[model samples]
Target: MQRIFAADIGGTNARFALFTGHEGSLGLDTVVWEKSADLRTAEDLLQIMQRQLQTPLAEGDMLVIALAGPTHGLRGKLTNGPLQVDLGGVGQRYGLSCCLLINDFTAQAFAALTPRGAGAKVVRGRALPDTESTQTKAVFGAGTGLGAASLVCCGGEAGFRHWLAVPSEAGHAPFAFVGAEEHAYQGFLARDLGCDMPTAENVLCGEGLSLLHYYLSGQFYYPAMVGEQVLSHDTPTLHWYARFLGRFCRQWILNTLSRGGLWIAGGIVAKNPQCVEHPAFLQELAAGGDVGGIVHATPILLTTDANSGLWGAARAGLEHLRGQTLAASAKG
Candidate 1:
């Protein structure tokens, strides 16, 4: 079996796991977690990984890291935080046979393609048509910020195989308001927060929840505390805020429909099950407007499992190993 290291880095925490692969099968085992706040640089985290590895680091072992940011060139810079590192340098310093860096959303997209446990909730949208050979899929997650990606699956006599996972910074796209109320809220966000370059992420993420609440209720509150109010379901402000979130989600789903379906993962949606489960939320999403025709073609929802990123990182490492082995065998 081939051994590889994989990690998913987020704002609050970092999860690391070891994957063992043979043939086309990959198994993720010995999962571990660490606080990102405790570490300074990416290399500092690597030292911790070295200590956790069951066996000593070898030249042939691979390392794959999924970060919550955009990878410019071969380097990735964290979105909500400041941490930039070179993928090639990390590989060389760690004695890795190879190192692959991917966006957290890309990792999540790949994980959605794989068969998941009972925890994953398939909320809306149709499954990929078996007859169609290559279908494109889109993925997005809301946490520190919104992340998006596109996944393409090719089908043949061999069955469906994921071909590509493309990373995107779609969260940075300008925000669009569908109704008068939303436009009013957008104006408020711009005035209060000085949000000139507002993106959908600005009004749809965790911070967005707080902004929505303040706009609707005329009360300013911290973003972290919005969850407590959302869970109680006692506040009319939060209820309306959840509806707004659903509408924003619908917009994102429509934008991603050029692909086959849309997958929503990450802490914001997964943790606030009550908000996502609200009747108003679903109704608002189904309420058709521009691009309403495409809503039927796309799927949207909060992924249930918290370990999706870890699973995805492991899968990426295993794929990298397979590609390297295939290339080596062809050369021989």
Candidate 2:
């Protein structure tokens, strides 16, 4: 068996998991959680995790880290916070066999392949037919920031199939406004941000939730307070927020052509499921003009597990180890 160390580091929290794998099977052994603000580097967090392990990481062990940002090669920085990772340095310092870096949403995409992801609640549309199981699937959610990724099955059959997770920065794309009312809201966001244009992330995350509440009610409160109000009663702010989220999700599905399905992850909708279950959200999602039928029929799932990112990282690491083994066999 081989040792696999995986981590999912977001803006607010970082999670680590240890797995024991042989062949294609992975057994999760340990998990740890820490506040992102407390740790300055990945190594520091690793040391903390090591203290809890009966068998610490050794040579030939694999390490995979998923971060909340666009990853370039072996290095990445969190989009919503001040955490940076250099995988090469980490690998050299730990004498690991393999070290990989990926986007947090990309990790979520991989998690979709697991039983936990398969068991997600269907919030909208019907499940895809088994014949179309190979079609593309998407995952996105709002938390400290907005995140998205798509999963595709490359050419292969059953046991030999390869899955790829394509990371997306769609949250950075320009948000669109339709009517005079929404146009005014857009202006409000721009002025609040002190920028020319507002991206989806600027108006769709935790801070955005608070900002939306402020824009509508003239009360500047935190997300927790707003979330409580939304859950406690039927508020206009809740309706508007749901509508905007639904609209954004609709655009993402269309953009990615996710005919297989779409899984909603992160804290926003997961904690406040009413957002996706509301009539306004459903109506907005199904309101596509010409392709309304397609949009309406797309499967929508919500994942509430907090450890999914860590599971995804471990899965990714096992795949990497398998690929390296295959390459070495070919060379031999």
Error of 1 at 112 (Å): 1.0
Best by lDDT: 2
Q: How high is the CA lDDT of each candidate model?
A: 0.68, 0.80
Model 1 residue 98 distance off true place after TM-score fit, in angstroms: 1.4
Q: For each candidate, what TM-score against the reference? A: 0.85, 0.91
Query: For residues 247-298, could you state the per-residue lDDT of candidate 2 as single tens digits?
Result: 9989988988887788999677888988988888888886767374667667
- Prediction 1 global C-alpha lDDT: 0.68
Off by over 4 Å in 1: 89-93, 117-119, 125-134, 154-162, 258-260, 289-294, 325-332
Model 1 lDDT tens row, 157-197: 34334357777777778876767876777788888778675
When summed lDDT is taken over every stretch of 10 residues in candidate 1, the lowest stretch is 125-134
